[model samples]
Target: MGMEYEKIHACSNDCLLYQNECEDLDECSVCHESWWKKVRLYGPMYLMWMYLFERYVKILKAYFKNRNRPEGCVMESYIAKEAVEFCSEYLSNAEAIGLQNKVDSDGATVIDFRKIGYKNDPFILATQVKQVFYTTDPNDLELSLVVLMKSRDIRDGEGDADDCNCIPSVSRGLTPVDEVDVFDDDDSNLVRLDVEWTYGTRSGGVNRDGIDYYNNLINELLSNGLEPFVTLFHWDLPQALQDTYGGFLSPKIVDDFKDYAELCYREFGDRVKHWIPINEPHIFTTRGYEYGSFAPGRCSPWLSPDCNGGDSATEPYLVGHNQLLVHAAAVQVYKTKYQNTQKGQIGIALNVPWVVPLSQSIADQEASNRALVFTYDWFMEPLKSGSYPAEMTTYVGERLPKFSEEQSSMLKGSFDFIGLNYYSASYAANGTCKRINPRASTDSCVVHLSERNGTTIGPKAASDWLYIYPKGIEDLLLYTRDKFNNPVVYITENGVDELNNGQLSLNDNIRVNYYADHLSFVQRAIRKGANVRGYFAWSLLDNFEWADGYTVRFGIVYVDYKDGLRRYLKDSAKWFKQFLL
Candidate 1:
């Protein structure tokens, strides 16, 4: 098709279609033949995939060379095994687990009768294989059968002399069994090839096993009657991307993030109905680029001496601009390509700390509104009306980047939903700073406080910045509903942390109370028609806390970091379990 071109010309008067028999006409031959034929290009039907295989090999080689062995072991032994087992168990319990009246290529009825179990203490899976008709929509039926039969034979030591060497040996190179001579009379020599029995076990090995882990998680959740709300990028930017182009600081990040988001939609969007493209852009831009407390730290020397070098006043705004652009790009891709087919809703998580007036004075009230404008409206205004907040333009002036008409048009209503991360609330008072330079923290002309005078708004959490204010969530929800025309919302992150004191008792009563109190407010907001849909506890387990360096625990399940990272369910976990029930 690339070699084919239509040497054709159309009449200037639009009298004829230049195609087929008219392709070779010299000029507008029908209309006095005044012009010569021009070339009409045709798109090639098939480009090529031969070159892609070589690049695919290179990708696999690089992936395995840098793969973490411990993580791989957990994935294969636990996550993958559990996924396969869940499918087997689910199908077994289903009323009808087949193609019903459909037949295989051989024109035969297919039936799934496979059983899977674990033999070893930690779980070495064994699957039972059975004969079945093949189908285009091959679920786990065939694979389970093969795995089960192979595992049974291996366990029973029933392989032929030469076939014994074909058994799978995980974590170790294949060791051939005793050699059998096949040169005897009426003997045929059979060569056994050792293989790894795992997902993506073929010639090109598994890269990005996290996909498998998440797939299993989604499958398990569905099997247990639950829906998954997946967040694609949660402030974990790749270090390599950061080194290559300073991560979110450059416009180049827009396409990269879009590609990543599209890949997530392609892979997991089938099961995940709610997609959050990026979580908490405000935190990522301010903390990582402005405060210089996070990875690839960059900030002005005046703000933090730990920073290598950066313009705090400029870089934060630049990063924030690029993040919004990237997010809008991802949302555009999802809406244009994936939303209809995948039937999924996409949104971005914005961490907004509800701002309250320090005093009943007009200045304090205005300051509180400015604080919200600088934080929430910084992103929401662009999303809602295709423009930045008027307050931001007036305060930041030239420090903030201006979006062109095209960019603003792309950003407007680029979400099917909105994810809000509300943890605590702060009182905002008119700023008194007369500093020469102002960054994001002070650009709003407001100061945030957890308390006024000697009285605090609410009890403080383990985190120094957090002060419990459950009513703030209800207020934020109601305000969002009214201001944003009642868009669907999810409380993506809302929880308190506790100190990890290395104690035997996992009695996190504070966390339990915190959840109960906050949930009561959420219920009130729901009653008032806030359009709130779902809520997520801040964390599932104790893990890294970025700059805090795991000094505090925010998980309902306690993790013993000193003891092989063992996990134990705290009282909060038990309480949460019952609450969910």
Candidate 2:
């Protein structure tokens, strides 16, 4: 395996077969010395016809299988046979394998990819992969297993494959629990810990135990050598406070969040550094306010309900004003009090969806632009430049509150990075700015992102409201980079949905493809100078999918709602772990 130097790119199973194209692309030195030493591996004419059939037949089968499964789950089914064996050989360990079986006559073997490695393991995850990939017959069953093994990582929920070097994801929205420990140097090893500044424990009450729970979770994660991420606020917004003051719409939240964040940082800052102050504020606010879907359930527009200036109700802009104040105040508090002690990155997360027009007409473009402004620019303006977007005034008029110069400066330049969450896209066409009729209030049709023909676009998925759109992710990222002068970005959330055990394998392969395509595009954006850093696949476990309310499963680890037993580790999770390693 020395002296024949040619560029090779084979890793898990992408073998870069080299050839001297100027003379003999056919005469591979390695192939000539194989089992059929006297015969050439291929004749010149056979190479073209062979790729069409021999090389891609399994790939085609996997495609049809993938189409019918969770989404990409179908496509991932067919992998290059060499790739399969490559994986089998790399992770060849058997400390915890629970199931191994031959799957039907075609000879596909389903091995538990997660259980391939123990504390001590080989590099060939499948029992055959060596230091570098070398040629084997395309029909090799072991290679096929490698393909399936990697695909399983991302196909559904977390599995035994959870032990990869990829960016790690931890539990979201934690609740406090009683802890027991053994008195030893490894005391931290006995606990499973995580931090949540504002999580609802039982009856949606603030678990006043964010600090203790997170401390243990962080210590345990550190003991396990896992890099922990602490999201300061997810929509859990201390139910007690929401009942006390009106939540984000009330400026009082600024003080409340400061105290809460202070406690979390004080407890877990050493082990937990990356902080997300709020997860998808746009989704939380719009879903709750305009749609009356989430917590606080306030449907009235942000300004006074009286456009005539009579009946006093909070208007949209006024509420936005409070959101800005709270966000800025919290950031200011973090910077003033904790920045010196804990030198970790902190930022806000945004839920970005693609907005496209049906046509090239100026009106149509304007419609699409307007939808984006209402949905994203509402928060983007304050985050990027510390002021509301100029367009808000046209949409909300007096309802869009004007922040004083002092407030604008306070909100400006406050983030270290941006966490982007994406799912789908919408078609926009001209529409009334704000609807006042009750009929309009009853329907969940988001006027902000709509099509004129009344036919909403984008491929349909588990959520009736979201149309699966891969390009939306690309557009949103490029757009964000252009708007914010290249802030660091991570795809904090991006997932597809599916039902388990109905007709399909609860395996979410489509979600896997969705991630690959979107991430591939994200990689391209990075090549083009977008400071995108990492990606966190939405949920680590299939738990309650808010609003949709547990109907849709997005975790890499499938949760058995009964007795809370989690059994399935998704294909996507497995694949992602490989990419990380």
Candidate 3:
């Protein structure tokens, strides 16, 4: 009664266990026997399966209230007994049944339930009792954090109570003051703020009120001992620019973006030492232009009737090419006009999942390489070599834009650092070129998969695409070092998400372990001579996650969406605080 056990129905002939994928099966496949059989096929129940456990069988049979539905009655009674036992453990002040309580080293009560049965009872080993871990002290288990400084990014719309377009009457009325306190409490030294071009720029000129809002936010962060790592653009294109010239799809937006960067540099560059001109251009172009899943959604009508009319085969490449040019123009402006005077570093954040070959076949191995070229190297290669990757040029052909000699010269070696946002990995297999309805999404001729031969590459997180493979971080860093000639790297975004179950609990051990495991790999990469400078968790507070809305939470500090957006420090924050101390 003190231990827990599950009622797993089995085939009467012992042909199979009716569980997991077989839970719904009404018959056994091996012997073609009915699943509800009450007796063994070979012998009487007392003389066969229950010979030694005759007394236990009698106890189980006594739980049945209905002769016709014996199994269901016994199951219902057993579940009720288990529920009562579980409730009593938490509701009562007395020691849990069959659990021995002792004081741990921290003078906190610890419960040990491993000794539930008689010492010499062989049958006890067959019971389904699992070891229980109980501790009263919050600090009993300390999660180790990486030695690198912690940073977090704030998107334009996040943390602001007022309209993103309107300036708040008071500074305190806009930015969540308590959220900044959480950052301080967690010992985070850096904050990355995404500056929306639309928020600060209109057809007339720079919005003074918008600039003032950022000024107030920057001052608040500095006052709290947090350094600003400002991102000039996080896909928040000014609608005016988009409407006038189709945004990044046209080369005209390049100068406009550069002007926006210059404005940010003049206003916030002195205080915001770290600048990331763009974030995840590959994601933006593919999702926005090719798949039409993001803002300014545009794709071929054949791909999606909802698309706002775009050429999937060419628009993504055009947009991506223009984004590279835009990034280069901004970097060129910063390095020439603002960087020396402001003493700041500028870079771009690129998100890419580490790609592993699906098999040892040469074609698959080559596909993995091509996949990286198309994603990470889509921007990085041009920055490194002043040319698109050879694989891209070969596969995408004329659809992929070519940089002029002047533009290529400007793009080469444009950044002081590279901001990397890695969250997951995928298996790559070779695929034939799509002659019909070809798009940038499949231009690399590589099939990306999250699983390999029925088993996932790693344990999946709440996000369907996010598989937990900590080693991928190290692999990516080392790949960057060897492939891109070891440019200064900062992990701009890395964190796991969990479903918002509409409960208020600050215990997020999964996130704590995620950080610990990934940072350990980062440390390994650093030891192996990868030039990673810092690590920023994806977010500090739970906010509206784009298309996911408020369904998934990816923050160390929990935000109560229902109750005036109250902030609470999750366990991961405590771990970071302790480690930083």
Candidate number of the best lDDT: 3
Count clashes in each candidate, considering only residues at least 3 apart in sequence or on different chains.
3, 62, 0
Q: Where does model 3 exceed 4 Å of error?
A: 1-182, 185-188
Per-residue lDDT over 1-581 for candidate 2, one digit per residue giving the tens place of the 0 to 100 score: 22233433222332223332213443333322222221121111111101112332444344232233311100010111222222233222212222222232334222222332213321111100001111233322112111111211233324231231110121111121111111111111111122333321211222333233345445554554344445665554544455456666677777766666665666566665667777677766555555444444445444323221211223334445676677677677778888778887777778877888877888878777767776677787887787777766554555566778887888898788777878888776565433553221222223444333666565566776677777787788788888878788766667777754423244566766666666656655654666665555555455444444345666654555443132355665455444333
Give the distance in Å from residue 366's predicted Cα in candidate 2 to where it truly belongs.
1.5
Q: How does each model score on lDDT?
A: 0.57, 0.48, 0.63
Worst 10 residues of 1 by lDDT: 177-186
How many steric clashes does model 3 contain? 0
Better of 2 and 3 by TM-score: 3
- What's the distance in Å from true for residue 224, model 2? 2.1
lDDT of 2: 0.48
For 284-346, candidate 1 gives per-residue lDDT tens digits of 788767887654567899887767578888898998899889889989998899889888888
The alpha-carbon deviation from the true structure for residue 130 of candidate 1, after best TM-score superposition, in angstroms, is 40
* CA RMSD, predictions in order: 23.7, 24.5, 25.5
